[model samples]
Each structure stands twice: as structure tokens, then as C-alpha cells.
Target: MPADENTAAEATEARRGRGGRGERGGAAARRAARSGGGPGQQLTYVTRKLPVYEVLGEEGIALIEANADTVLEEVGIEFRGDAEALALWKEAGAEVKGERIHFPKGLCRSLLSTAPSIFTQHARNPERSVQIGGDATVFAPVYGPPFVRDLDGNRRYATVEDFRNFVKLAYMAPNIHHSGGTVCEPVDVPVNKRHLDMVYAHMRFSDKPFMGSVTAPERAEDTVAMAKILFGEDFVDQNTVIISLINANSPMVFDETMLGAAKVYARHNQATIITPFILAGAMSPVTVAGTLTQVLAEVLAGAAFTQLVRPGAPVVFGTFASSISMQSGAPTFGTPEPSLVSYGAAQLARRLGLPFRTGGSLTASKVSDAQAAYESANTLNSTMLAGTNFVLHAAGWLEGGLVSSYEKFMMDVDQLGMQQRIAEGVDLSENGQAMDAIREVGPGSHYLGCAHTQANFQTAFYRSAIADNNSYEQWSSEGEKAAHQRAGQLARQWLDTYQAPALDEAIDEALKDFVARKKDSMPDAFS
Candidate 1:
């Protein structure tokens, strides 16, 4: 298509995407972007707006753009680990030596323009829907290192079993919509085998849209092979991978691993989900606006690279921004930064007419205490309200998503259910919210068994577990437990009653054989 035709198509689609549930982010964003709007209106939980960055006004956007440019120039990524990757990087105009491959700022920036902004991944249970490059919830549990201590006070790592259980939980989790499936324990499997194991678990547990981590460039083909094995020879060709994640080091730089993976995934028509995080007041300019501009720049440069690799290869804009705690000097997420950044990034994604991804139930909280509830509530509220289509770290997160908790998993789901209710967004249709029932009661009479209420009670109110649904005496009799306690109990019940999915006898045998073969063939990695 000519440049003019492409622009025309974008313009037309942008207009058409404005009013549906999928475009909730688009609607709330416009409302919040209005100048001089009241603080309440701009608050992410109340309406769709960028998470509240300390930087207000145009400066925030400026910071995002500037940082992106910095990344392109001084911090270009290079692949130095594997021969195939090195060859590809060099062919792609990346400069390299030893274990690092680099690229030109201009080339990096150019790729952002042509990347495909939308793609799809069909789920086995058609009821489970995920639109990778659209406006809808596509949540995945947190990935990366684990740092939380268990009841024994021993620090737990992300082992293969841990990865499998997490994937299993993700399968059972009602709100956790995506899987960073290869979530690994640093030592459980060697880098190469880990991807295969992760993919194997995913193919067995679910036929959902998932992704491969670009933690290392050398492992890219292994991840791709997993896709091939699961979906057959045309996996990449069928666009079954949907989207692949590419993480850009914040402050400034695209590491070799992430960049090369982006190229490989894009070659297959998979969307590249690239997120550049700025530890505000740390890796980023302290000012909120300045940080945003930098963050945006980081993402845009990568988006451009994705476009260059294969114009219109599916890509979803990702924003992972957090602030530094002045007292601790450590980065803090699950705070206002995650939401604020999500909001701003969604705005930018809208500006570009692409799907947006953001964090959820985010926090820097440790235990599942009040702090956990507070942080989780705030982040999830912001993401759903902002209409983020791809919500990451949505459940099974504890200790800022570094640890998985069966307990916290259910808690997050409960919280998400509440948010979904809110997003169901005031059913004020003439007969929707049951306004007629309220009017019939007319300011004082009890509507306990009113005809209208009898007909529509279920639709009229927000229900809850520890949400105070009883008289003082009734409550006293049950022992007033806090919301978290109720949530905790619910988690236990699910685990106790949960039936592990039964695999086909032949399929199960195949899986066992595969693991056994991997263990035998690569003792160091699998054993």
C-alpha cells in the first residue's frame, strides 16, 4: 500500500474504534486529556487517563520522547551470544564485538513506523478471548526473578515445577488472561531447555495466547521451536505466537537479547510487546513529565524497529514505569507510577492507533496485608479504568510480583472481579441499573421485596464477601474478618477443591517422554 493509503486506513480505523468496550481506554483517555480538567476527572481510577505522573502537562510527554532518543543513540542493542543471532544482527546493520551487538540510532528509530499494530491468537476454548493488538484484557502473571521468602524463611526460586504450577494457576485463574509461560527459576533448566519446557506446559495446560521471554538472545530459536512444535510447522506463519515481549533497559538501552528476539518474532507476524521502564528519580529524570517523555521515546524507538523489521508486524505498546523511593532508593511499583504511566502510555498508543498494555495489581508490597490490598486495589483500578487491553502481572503476585502465592492469586481475582463490575460501568439504560425500583421506593420505604427489585436485584448492587452485607448481630455471629482474610480463605478453598486438569493418556505419556528425553539429553540443563 502507498503511504497515503496506509494513513487513510489508519485514520478510518481510529475513528471506527472509538466507542466499543474494546476501546474503553480510548474513551477514558479523551476525557482525561482535556486541559484544566478537575483532578478527580483526571484520576485514573475514576476515568481513563495516564497514571498520575508527578510530571504534569507537556513536560511528561517530553521526557518520554527524549529518553527514547537517548536509547537509540548511545545504547543500541547487540547480539553477541549465539552465532545465528550475531549473523542476523550484523545483517540487520547492528555493530558488534565479543558478546555485545549494537545498532544505529537512525535504523532503530525507523523500524518503529512500519511495525504491524494488531494481531490475534485463537484460544482453544473459544469462550476465552484475547485480542493481542486490540483493546481488551490480555493479562499474564509476572515473570523474571523471584525474591520472596516462603513460610520457612528460605528464599524460593522460580523452578520448573513452580513455572508449571503458575501456568496451571493461570489456566484456572478467571482474570489472569495471559501467560509469560516460560516463567523460570534461574537454575531449574538451562537457558535452552527452559523455553521448551515452558512451551510444553503451555501447550498442555492451555491453547491460549502466550509468549516467549527475550531474557537472552541465544535462546530465541528455542522459543520459536516450541511454537512450531505446539502448533505445527506453520506456527509462525499462522501468527499463533500473537505477541512476543521485548524489554528495553530503562534510562537508556536495548539489550541484545530483547532486540534480536523482537526481530525474530516480527519476522513471523507476531506482535512485539516492548516495555521500557524508567525508575523515576532513579533511572529517569525525577520530574514526572520528563520521565514520561523518556519512556515514550524508549518505546517508540523499539516500536519503530518492529515496524522496520516487517512493516505492520503485530505490535502492542507497553509502558512499565515506576518511581524511586527517596527513603529506600529502590524502585517502587504498585504505586501511582504504574497507573500514571499506564494512562499516559495508553494515550500515546491511542495517538498511534495501536493496542496498549499496562500493569495490574501492581505493588511494592511484601505480605498480603493491608499494604497489599491497598496497592493491588489502586493499580488494578487504574488499569481497568484506563482500559488497558493487555494487563500484565494481574494475579498470583506477591512481593511485587517476584513471588507467586496461591493465596494472593485468588485475592487478585476477587479484586479483578470487583473492577470488572465497575467497568461494567453503570448500567443506566432505562431498565438497566433498576432506577425504577429506587423511584418506586421514593425516598424511605424499604424495597426489600419490591416488585422491581424482585425482578432486578442481582443487577442493581455491587456484591462482596467481606463487604458488610449484614446487620451488626449477624456480622458478629460470623466473626468479622477483613477482606483479605476472606480472600485468603477463598484461595485455600480453590486449591483444596481444584482438580488438576487431566491430560489425554497419550498426550500425558508424550509429555512425560519429552521431559525424560530432555533430562537425559541435557542433564545439566534439565536435571
Candidate 2:
């Protein structure tokens, strides 16, 4: 094709890509750019504009902190089979009794002072860099689900293709800030080598900041190496590029794998979210206070250990505790107990002065039904009010996190935009006051034809992409599709129309070659 014809086609595609879900991050710059509208054009990062709602009073906070200290000193926590970690604990002035390390009253808290309260997680595209901690809340999609569901209502094991599609959808969803780690577990890919593919997909498809692998110590190392290739090793060492998740085994246990991964990330000054996986009544005591004590102790141990690995290493104090159904022994979602735990955990994290990570749009419904909507709404509200800094599973989570629904992904993305609007709070600026418009339209006159109303019409009201606001007769005339169905349509349309952010050819080739070499060196192990 001729140069002119090719440019015309590119412009057409760019136009078709416009007018997506919500206001993009850099819309004016996107329109002025000569190149095609790429993912880099719009990076929607949410900064919390609302005040935090504290659930625990000062006395409650003091009591919890005191109890947490007692648990650490008297009860102690176990570092199973991690001789190196135990040795480090011993060197850090903790009393080491075999694998169990007992801290003195304020030992862990003293060590936590080394971790930075806030840091930037850089993306391949610098515009998409995210500030973790303080007043920012970065929204990431559903992570680590082994199964996937499509628009056809089919449920099955996720494939590499499905994983790539999810990446594309995440890239397309402007509301999602980070391309999270393991958007879905690609079952078709060998267990030993999926991280390579996952990281490569994130690097290639999206320009957003993404999570690093923590499945194994070596996997975390591979993630760093790949990041070095994308963003030079010197840049990566000085700047926090990837934030990895390190889970602690509940009931006061720190597994070797999570510790090893944290060690690797901390060694390079990368950020790690030291999280405690708690299920009340099962992994923890049924009461919120008991669970809060355990959550604090576990994070203090894991996060403090990261500081031991490298002082001033960036780490997020994370909480993922939920209640369980006693009757069926099943995990519940969007319940009161989890909200209380999340709120209290946020207060505890603030008290310790560390960045916090929690869940979003959490639900246990098998499909994207009424239960999914209400549950997700409740979860999102609690997370926002709790002032979360990094939100994982912000969208598409379903069936107690066993599956990621395509429709729900879109639905939750829309809701996330709504949350961002809500967090912005009511504007009080002169323009926002609308006094002139009110005076101009006073005395039996409508504001619809006023200049202020016309001026602010585009942005004055929150526009929903998947919501149906038509009359009942008009909705029935248009087939009366439900919210989930409309979301499915938007999901499919986004996938079909998705254009991956352009990467330099040399860098893209180098990343692919590196992934291939790493995969070839590993044996296929499915366990």
C-alpha cells in the first residue's frame, strides 16, 4: 500500500478506538499525536481524592498493636526450613529457637522503619508509572485464577491464548492501572515455564506497570533479568520497576518459597508486597480482633525480614483475610467480617507507616449474576473507604476466585471508574459551584439551555459505558439485555479492537529470545 493509504488506515483505526469506557489519562495528547492511538496514549491512574474512613479508634489501635507485640514476643513465629532466614532473624536481635524467632517488644517495628513509605513502580512506558502508597489507589485486574469463562458461558482451563487475550483486555480497559501478575493461570503451558510467558505478555501487550513473579525464587530472578533487558539494569537497580507479591503461610508460618522470592526482590531494591493469606475461622480465629492481631504479626515478620535483607527496601504491608462459611466450609466474599478486617488492617498499616495492598471486586458467585454485582460493589466500597494503595483482583474475580469471567471483568472495570469518581468527592471550585448557572436559570427557568450547563455537560455527569438508562419501553424494544450481557459485548469489542502498545523492535525481539532461551533450558514439569 502507498504511504498515504497506510496513514489513512491507521487514522481510521485510531478513530474507531476512541470514545472508550471513561475519560482517558492523556486524551488531548492522544489526539495530537501523529502515530496510531496506542495503549501508551491513555494511562488512567487513580489518585484518592477523598478522605479515609477509620474503623478502629485510638484505643482499639493501641490495643491491637500491644497484642501484636505480645504475640511476636511470647508466641513467636516459625520460619519453616529456612535456615538462612532464621540466621538473619537471629542476627537482627530476635531470639531464634530453631525455626521459631521471637522478637523483643519493639524489635520488628524498629526494623520496619527502614522500609520506605512510598515509591514509584515504573513502567516500560514512563507515563504509566504508578505511585504506591499515600493517597493513590492503583487498580489491577483479577490475578491467579486457574480457570476462565468466555461470553458463550463455557468454563474451562485457561490457555496461553486466553492469558494473552486477558492481557489485551486489561490493556484496553483504561480504568485498570496495572497489568497484574498471572491474570489467569495458563494451564496448557507447563507449570515450570509459565512465568516467562506471563512476563513477556505483560511487557509486549501493555505499557502499564505490572507485578513480578513470586512462584519461586528463580522465577523472581528471571523476572528481574527480563526487566533489566527492558529497562536497563542500572535503571532497574536504582528505580523500583516491579512489585511482587510474597504470601506468608497463615498461623504464624513463613514458607521458604515466599521468603526466597522476597529475598531476591529485596536484594535488588525492588518492591515486594509481604502479604498474609488469612481465612477467618479456618486459618485464623473467627473474631476480627484476633484476625487483626495475626495479620499484623505476620506482616511485621515478613516485611521486617525484607528490611533485614536490604535496608530501605520498598515493601507493602498486605492483608487478604476473608471469612469462611461454617456450614459448607466454603469461602465467602464481600462479607462484614472481611470489610472490618480490611478497615482495621488499613488503620494498622497506617500506624506502621507502610504502603498497603488489598482486594477489590471480590465475590464467590459461579457466574456474572446478581450476586456477583452486589458482592463486588460491597467489596469495592470497603476497599476504597479503607484507603487501599494497591488493589489486586479489582475486576473479573468470580467463584471465590477460582475463575475470571470476561463479562465481570468489563462490569467491574466500569464500577472501578465509578469508584474513582466517587473518590474525587464533590467538587467545590467556582466552576463546580454552578452559582452563575443557578442565577441565570432562576425563577421557573430550566438550566438545560444555560451556558454553564452547556459548558460542563460532557464532564459534569458520570457517564457509564455498560449501564442502560433508557426507558422500559425503549429498553424492551432494544431486546432488554442485562448488564452482564452488555459487559460481555464491551469485553468482546475491546478484545477484537485491541491494539498492543508498540515496543521497539529490538527490545521486543530481545525479550522474546530471552524467554525462549529460558524455556528451552528448563525441563517440562507439571506438578
Candidate 3:
């Protein structure tokens, strides 16, 4: 029997049982039989519990909330070209003028009440699953880059092969928690049909949780359908397996295409990140406070819309705030203003009891040079401090999001290791204190040979694979390769050694057939 048929039979059995015990037992059995169950799988990297750095006090938070509400009621937001969304808003007691939606004060917040404070996002490999929201920060790779930087330092339009390789890199990297969506745009693939290939690549190349398609409503449907085939319809319905990005057309607009994709994910109870893509002084206000207010208002409207679609639907309060350099009309990243805005936005999300998403290893540097290193580190530190739950572009970001550099990807992944260790903080357990080692070593003796040091030496400290920690003489003896050189070597090494996770042969065949049929049914359409 098909999985859905078995599910229906189990439901019938539960209904006929005397108590609810049989029903609970049936549910337990179904969960145990969930796909992706296996042993000895690597666990996804997660942040240990730590205090989130808050830049905003009570007054600042209140002022931002008040300004956001003002923007909602007085300024209003546009849900352009989405009639159903406009109608839904109207029925929900909002004043709709064409595509613009004006909500009464407190309505958006009230609607957001049903959204879960934290939710579990399952992966194909059960051990790779992650808890998104709260203090737990989930790091994902760079998203939506259209160009790729090769090891030989050549930049070109990304292809389907480049896409698959990035997926493999994400799979092999222990730091990245989610496989992510649109690692890069494959210019060689048709716009309409590319989503199918992207989803297939993620399904076959990585076992980590990943985002779903949001390019069009049909593509979003395809994502759900494909997920159903892999995880079973019942499992997909019961658990949040996909976390799709639903970006808001900033300056108070939500495009029809994005809204349509969001509706599908919301209805299915899959997670969606409601991000306000703001470039301060360009897409939003010039001031950080002003930009933060707009971000809050846009996210509030989007999050509320998700709840209206399906109450208790998992939604992330997201912000993609950057600044436009006054000297040039270019967008800048890892600047002080965006960091401040991100800090406040996180507080706002916390105030509304929603998960926050923002910050990454963002940089406008063209190469993996010193500028790239500093900028990337600045953003990563901000995200870690602000307690961002889902960090898109956590690694591999380059040239103001226009390219994904392989060398930078490896270097950033290594830095993410440092962040993880810092988040773990100081362990004060009896063993961690190392009182025995101190006593054994006494005043001036070395503790390297002590029992405690010998026992815990392997895991004692973070060892950097990218950074050279050798003495000057030792460094001179060996070729003094730069960080990027070492990182490039590591990137190529990972690609050379990566092995795709094992999947059931029947399911793999089904996935391939589904892709072939879907591609055949649609003519290539480029937007």
C-alpha cells in the first residue's frame, strides 16, 4: 500500500479504538517510521545557550514598535498585484486601497500571536534536523548569487554543475546547518524549469534541511510535491521540513509571486522567512532607526499574513538591511549602521515573540582579500551577538552578493568554527575547571604532561585549519601560504572527497522520474 493509504488506515484504527491510547500509539509508530532515520549520522552545528547582545533598551524597543505601527496605519504597505491577499486583508478588517493594505494598530501583533516561538525543522537525515528560533542560531550558506569564483580566480556565470558542487560543499561542511535555497542562479538553466533541478540537487547531494522554491506558485507547488515523494505526504504535513524565503519587495511592497509562494508554504505548515530587503538610503529611510522601523513594519505585515493564511504557521521575522554608500550608488555590507539596525531588529522580533533572522558573512569586496576578511568577520560577529536564528549568506558571500567565492566560502566556514566555540562559552564543570591539572603542575611546572591535560588535550581548544600558527622559523621552512591559498586548497579537497549520502534506490528513482516528467511537461520560459 502507498504511504498515504497506510496513514488513512491507521487513522481509521485509531477512531475505532476504545480509549485514545491506540490513537497515540498509532501516531508514535508513524513518527518512528519517518524517512531519514538512520544511525551514526553527523549532527548539525548549533549554538550553545548564551545571552543575546541587546543594543536597544525598553524605551528604544517601544519607540520602534510605535513607529512601525505608525508606518502600518498611516503609511500603509502595498501587496501589489495580489488580489487574493488584498481581499484576505479586507475580510480580516483591514482597509485596502487597491494593492495597499492599512491595518489598525495592534492588529498585526494580535495575528502574530498564533505563530510558534520556536519550531523544529526536520532533515532527510534525522540527525541533521535543527531547532530554529529562540537562542539557537542556525547557520546556512550564501544564497542567490549568480556568479561563481573558481580556485584559479576566474569569475563567471554559475552553471548547473556549479550549483551541484556548492550543494556538495554545504553537505561536507560541518558548520552549515541548512543546505539553503538558490546557492547560486544557474544562468544555463531556464528560469521556469531551474527550480526542479535545484530541488533535485539538494535532495540528492545533501541530507541537511533546506529551503523550498519561491520563484513562482507553480514552482512552490513542485517543491511541496517533491517533498511529499521523499518524506511522504503524511510526514510533510506533520513536520516542518522546508523553510522557504519569502522576501518582501522593500519600501512597503510584497510582490504577487513571493506572496503566492508564501501562501503555499504557510498552508502546508512549512517555515517561511518573512524578510524585508532594505537598503538604507535607497530602498528605505536613511537613518538606522528609520530603516529599522520600516523593516519591523514590513516584517510584521508579512508575518501576520502568514498567520492569517494558517494560524500557528512557523514564520521568521527577517531583515536584510544594508546601506547605500553616499560616494557611489552601490550597496555596502558589514557597515556599522546595518549592524546597529540588525541589533535592534532582533530585539523587535523578540518583543513580538517571533524567531529573528538576519546578518551573515556579507562583504562588497571583490576577492578573498583583507577587506573581505574584515568585512565578513564584522558581519559574522554581529549575527552571533544579535542572536540571529537563521543566517543566510553565513558563508561564501562576495562582491555585494553578486558572487559566491570558493576560497571565501572555506575561510568563512573556518571562522564559523570560532563562533561556535565562543558561543559554547566557558564550561565551569568540575572536569572543565581542571583543578587536578593545576594542582599537579603547581607553581612553574608545565601542565602539558599532566593527567588532566593529557586526557582533554584533543578537544581542549579550537585548532584553525586556515590560520597558520607556526613559529617564524617553522613558517619559513614550509611554504608560507596565505589564508586564501590554504582555503582554496581546502575547498578543492572537500569537493574531491565529498560522497553523497545514501538514499533508498526506489526513492531516488522516483525523484529522477519526477524531475524528468516535470521538465518535459513545461516549455522553457525565461522571465
| Candidate topping TM-score | 2
Q: Give the TM-score of each candidate.
A: 0.76, 0.93, 0.92
Q: What lDDT is obtained when candidate 2 is compared to the true structure?
A: 0.85
Of 1 and 3, the candidate ahead on TM-score is 3
In model 3, which regions exceed 4 Å deviation? 1-43
For model 1 the local lDDT of residue 453 reads: 71
What is the TM-score ranking, best to worst?
Answer: 2, 3, 1
RMSD for each of the candidates? 9.5, 6.8, 7.7
Tens digits of per-residue lDDT for model 2, 1-527: 23542343344333222222333456543441212122334535777788898889999999999999999999999998788999898888999998899999998989999888888887765557788999989999999999999788799998888889888888876678899989899999899899999999998888778999998899999999998888767667877889999888998999888988999999999999988998899999999999999999999999999999999999999999889999988999989999999999999999999999997999999999989988888888999999999999999899989998899998898888778778878889999899999899999989899999888765666567778999999999988899989989877777877876767677778889999999999799888
lDDT of each: 0.59, 0.85, 0.85
> Model 1: runs farther than 4 Å from truth?
1-110, 145-155, 182-192, 433-444, 465-482, 500-516, 525-527
Lowest summed-lDDT stretch of 10 residues in model 3? 15-24
Give the lowest summed-lDDT range of ten residues in model 1. 36-45
lDDT of 3 by residue, 1-527 (tens): 23553454345322222111111234433322221111112335566667888998999999999999999999899998888899889999999988889999999999999999998887776557788887788989999999999889999999999899888888877677889989989999999899999999998888788999999998999999998877878777877889999999998999999999999999998999999998899899899889989999999999999998999999999999999988898998878999999999999999999988999999999999999988988888999999889999999999999998899988887787778778888899999888988888999889889899888765577666678888988877877888899889988887886767777667778889999999999899877
Candidate 1 at 527: error in angstroms? 13
lDDT of 2 at 150: 78
